[model samples]
Target: MHNIKDLRKNLDYYKKKLLNRNYNLNIDEFVNLDKDNRNLISKKEKLEQEKKILSKSKNKANFEKSKKISEEISRLNKDQALNKKKLDFILHTLPNLALDDVPIGKDEKSNKLIKKFGKIRDFNFTPKSHVEISSNEIDFETSTKLSGSRFVVLKNKLALLERALINFMLDVHTIQYKYTEVSPPLIVNEDVMFGTGQLPKFEEDQFEIKFNNSDQRKFLIPTSEVVLTNLVRDSFTKKDDLPLRFVASTPCFRREAGSYGKDTKGMIRQHQFYKVELVSVVEPKNCLIELDRMLDCAKKILDILEIPYQIVLLSTGDMGFSAEKTYDIEVWIPSENKYREISSCSSCGTFQARRMGAKYKINNNNEFLGTLNGSGLAVGRLIVALLENNQNEDGSVTIPDALKKYMNNLDKI
Candidate 1:
């Protein structure tokens, strides 16, 4: 959410910034509505003043006049509220402005590759996709029968591997990186979702829940990032705790609304999947710095898994709704003969904080906090990369050294 005062004063500046994001702001509509709302506020204040003056007299005429003024004030209050609601609706739909140094473009095609790590392994024979390699263990047929498409059932060692991956990520983040581990609720209220920029706009992509006895809006979290970042919602943190880092491994559910016919053959895209999410809350000035640290934390997981990956700075148009700048880590998929996104680390600046009402005190003044979130790594996609990259000609998969302990010293699956 943007400060209305700032938007009112710097309309032209915001117009250009939003345009780069491919969002066309209705400047004229906003200006007219703002003016009307302010006018109503002024009128209401004058009527209240008149009522106060009238209250000084006990005369019948004055009483009647005061009652009339009170009614007028009530009417103006409603009008102002309705006007503000319309204005806020517009503000809520606008995407965060991109950081100055972010590349300006309309989509991912213009994204910039920042770094490449590890060597892509050379296989003597043709490598098979995860679906083909784990045909016996990963049962999509059973999952489809139970829950339709975009779901999977990993049996035998593959099931153990998924659990191991989640545990491995949580340990690395909490023990080595100093993030506080949290097990947050999978279902959240509407306001909680809105606080994280997942409501009102991206409603279609969410799996909303309904109840026969309650009116409260609820949803299955698309990622633990929604719950982890919102831990600071409607609250203030002490300066001593400048950066609050949190990690969670959870089952994420998404509608995949506009993603039909994409990555349908494998676990690349799914309605249900596990993810180790990382969220950090810090001072606004240190947001970018925290982002760099967060990116490294996520990259560390892939490094430990010995996966070859590259980092890309997303274009302004490709960044998430709440992020000012974003970095995506794409891991090499041997079967696809390409790199696919396994993690996306983003610096939301104070955009989410403003929406969440999350703040920190600085010299007696409360200021919006900076928030960042990233996939420490998507468990399912990581599994795909691990299996495809480590597959043997005989069909067994070699486990990476880092996960060997977690797998009870079993080096192969």
Candidate 2:
């Protein structure tokens, strides 16, 4: 969320930016409302102070005057509501500021590629798409009959392949990267969603449920980022816990709203999938290093699996709502004949902390902490990439060396 102060102090600058994002909020009205709110608070404070003095006197006339002041306070409280509504309207329009180095682009077409890796697949005979080759192993028709489109049920070796990928990622993150492994809830409250910048926006892309209490409701977490990042929500930790690294492998749910017919074939797009997520809470000065570390952790997964991939820096308009910068890892998919996003690493800066109120008391000083999160790897996509990249001419997948142990030393599945 953006601060109303920015809108009030730099109306002209934000006005131009707002046009770029297609947001409509009258700047003058917002500023006036904010100014009114300040005045109302001032008036309320003054009235309370005067009433305090009058109450000290404890005379009958003073009592009547205090009562009148109380009535005036009630009226001002009513006026404050209108001011608050206007203030909220403006705050909701505040755009997530792009990082200084983020490339200025209109959309994905303008995103810049930082690097590439490995070679695209070649076939002696006509190579089948993943959906074609894995047909005997995957039950998509039954999945659709049971659930709906964009769902898959992995059976036989395909199921083991997905499980092997998840285990490999979690082991690497916990043992090699020294991150604390956690099992977080798949369901979270609205405040947790807001803390991660999911609420007040992107609501339709989520799945919500009514809770035991009629007034309470919860959302199925769209990503472990919401659950992991909010662990320190509203917290003030010591500097020794400066760089808190967390990793979790969990099932994530998404509505895929508005993407009804896109990537409708297989696991490339799905309503539910498993992923090993990486999150870090670190000192402000150490955030960039943490981002690199996160990328390294994710890259290790691709490197170990020997899957061809590229690292691309997302453009300003392409970055997420909360991210200051983002690096998307697009794995080579032979079937699609193009790269597909398998993981995204981002530095959200203090955007999430500011919303969640997750902060730290720096050594002998008061300061808020910073937060960062990324996908160690999205497991289903990893399976898709692995199957497509390592497919044998005989229609079996050659297990990557790193996953051989997890797969019981089997060379091919």
Candidate 3:
């Protein structure tokens, strides 16, 4: 969310920025609504002052005048409240302004490649997809029968491999990177989702949970980022606790509402998957710096696994709703003959902080804290990368040296 005062003061500037993000600002509607709301407030204050003066005089005429003033104030209050609601709706719909340095573009085609790491393996035989490499253990047919498409049931070693990857990622982030690991609730209230900029906009993409005889709306978390980043919601932290880094490995649920026919095969896009999420809370001034560090932390996972990947700076329209700037770590998928996004590191600046009411106290002043979140790595996609990239002609998969210990010293699966 943006400061309403700032949006009012720099309406043109914000409109231009939002335009790059493909949002058309209805300036006239906002201006008129704001003007009317402020006018109503002014009228109400004037009536209250009159009623105060009338109350001092005990005459019947003064009493009637005060009664009329009270009714007028009541009416104005409702008008002001309604108008403010409309204004806030507009504010909530607006996406975060892109950082000035971010590339302006409509889509990923305009995204800039920042760097590439490791070498893409040269397969002597025509490489198959993860499905073909582990058709027996992947068990897509059974999973589809059990829970429909976009779901998988890994059997035996493949299941163990998935758990090992999650553990390996958590260890790297929590132990080496100093991120505090948390096991948060899988289901969260609506406000918690809104705190991370996932609600009131992307409602269709969420898997909402319905309850009998309950008014409270709940949802299965789309990512651990929702829970991890919201730890500072409606609270103030000390300056010494500036960067609160958290890591969590949890099952994520998404409806994939917008993606009707994309990545229908394998684990590329799933309704349920495990991810080791990384979130950090910091002072706004150091947000970009922290973003760079966070990006490195995520990239380190691929480095340890010796997986080939490339980093790209997402263009304005391609960035997430809450991110002012973003970097995507796309791992090479041998089957797809291309790189697919395995992690996305983003600096949300104070966008989420404002919505979350997350603040930090310094020098007796409270300022919104900056929030950043990224996939330390998506376990499912990493699994796909591993199975396809390390597959042998004999159909066995060679485990990376870093994960061998977690995989019970088994080099091949």
Candidate 4:
């Protein structure tokens, strides 16, 4: 959520920034509504003052006048409520302003590839896609029978590989990187979802459920980031708690609402998948520092796995709704003959803090805290990259050295 005071203080400044994001919002409409709301409040207060004076007089005419003023006040309050609703609607829908360093563009094509790592593996035999390589292990037909499209069942070693990947990533993030491991609830209330910018605007992409006994609706988390990052919701932290980092491995669900026919063949796009997510909360001033540190932690997974990948700095228009800036780590997929996104590290620069009511106390000041989240590694896509890149001519996968212990020291699966 945006600070209404900031918008009201300098509407034009925000309007220009948002225009760069391809949103043509009319600040004039909001300004007018704000003016009208203030006018209504002023009118109501004036009438209330009159009522106070009239009640003290206690005369027949004053009493009659007070009754009429009460009616006007009631009508103005209703109007004020309507105007405030409209104002809030506009404010809530506005996306976060991109940082000045972000590349200005309309979409992903404009994203900058900051660095590329590892050499593309050379295979004497023709490389096969993960779908073709793991045909015996990943059962799409069974997944279809159990659920629907964009789902898959990994059996035998493939399932173990997926679990192994999750544990390995969590180990790297927790043991080496010092992120506290957390097992957060998968089902969250509406407020928790909203705190992570998954509600109000992106409800269509959420899987919502209703309980017969309660009015509150619950939704399955689209990522562990939603749950891990929200641990500090409605919290007042001391400066000693300035930097809090957490890691979790959880199942994520997404409706993929508008992405109808894309990546429909394999695990590239799935409704259900496992991910090892990392979240960091820090003082506002340390946000960027934490972002770089967090990015390194995510990149370390690809590094340890020895997967060839590139880090792309996302363009403003291509960034997520809540991210002020984002860096996508795209691992090389030989099947697609391109790099595919395996993780996105983003610094939300107090955007999510305002939404979640997370604040840090510095002396007497309570300032909006900074929050960052990234996929230490997305298990499904990681599996895809692992299978495709490490496939042997005999159709078995060679587990990375870093993950061998987690997979019972079985180097080949």
TM-score list, all predictions: 0.98, 0.95, 0.97, 0.95
Q: How many residue pairs clash in each candidate?
A: 0, 0, 0, 0
Model 4: lDDT of residue 73: 89
Q: Which pairs clash in the backbone of model 2? A: none
**Number of the candidate with higher TM-score, 2 or 4:** 4
Estimate every model's Cα lDDT from 0 to 1.
0.94, 0.84, 0.94, 0.91
List the candidate 2 regions with Cα displacement exceeding 4 Å.
3-26, 363-365
Model 1 scores a C-alpha lDDT of 0.94
Mind giving the per-residue lDDT tens digits that candidate 1 earns over 296-408? Answer: 99999989989899999999989999999999999999999999999999999888999999999999999999999999989999999999999999988999999999898
- Our model 3 lands, by Cα RMSD against the true structure, at 1.4
RMSD of each: 1.2, 1.9, 1.4, 1.9
Q: Name the weakest run of 10 consecutive residues (lDDT summed) in model 2.
A: 16-25
- Considering lDDT, where higher is better, how would the candidates rank from best to worst? 3, 1, 4, 2
Residue 3, model 2: Cα distance from true site in angstroms: 4.4
Q: What are the per-residue Cα lDDT tens digits for candidate 3 across 285-383?
A: 999999999999999999989999999999998999999999999999999999999999999999999999999998999999999999999999999
Estimate, for each residue in 319-365, the C-alpha lDDT of model 2 and write its tens digit.
78778788999999888788999999998887788788887886577
Cα RMSD for candidate 1? Answer: 1.2
